[model samples]
Target: TQLLEQSPQFLSIQEGENLTVYCNSSSVFSSLQWYRQEPGEGPVLLVTVVTGGEVKKLKRLTFQFGDARKDSSLHITAAQPGDTGLYLCAGGGGGATNKLIFGTGTLLAVQP
Candidate 1:
């Protein structure tokens, strides 16, 4: 089975800090998605990068997919208290299931 592992399961920082989270896997995926979730709510899509070596940016967040499609990264710049949430990376397989395999997640706390 394919699996995604995330690093620094927890993070705390002062407002306006910067951080990077990594998602890795041994299996290649057709597409990968990044989602940010707040407490007691479902995750909202941040971005989806499909092509290998693809890079997408949203505000202070930057997402990159590895050339091998087996890994991805999320970089946050000048993070604010509003950025505090659970970050997740999901991979989409090419099979008929087309289900998303989610990472363990990273809980970020940005202090004001």
Candidate 2:
């Protein structure tokens, strides 16, 4: 049973605030991806970390993969109203079932 759990299913914050979202699992993954989705649209890939303890940064967003490949994290610095959206984490096993497994999902609202 491979499952991914995410904390803080919902978040509301003021502009310029910092926030972190977590993704955890009991099974190892070959790769992990972070995505941000808007209303009525597909999620946009934010980052993909393949190696354990790998870290990647995109502008104000930072992503980290767990050393065991069973967890990941996303940190946003100086969050703005424009950052309000749904954040999703997906894991890839890299086998015959290379399909991604998504977390429950997170909704973030950044008030101006």
Model 2 ranges off by over 4 Å: none
Which 10 consecutive positions of candidate 1 have the poorest summed lDDT?
92-101
Instruction: Spell out the clash pairs found in candidate 1.
Output: none
Query: Candidate 2 on 19-110: residue-level lDDT in tens?
Result: 99999999999999999999999999999999999999999999999999999999999999999999999999887968999998989999
Cα TM-score of candidate 2: 0.97
**RMSD after CA superposition, every candidate:** 0.6, 0.7
lDDT, candidate 1, residue 105?
99
lDDT of 2: 0.95
Worst 10 residues of 2 by lDDT: 1-10
What lDDT does candidate 2 reach at residue 111?
100
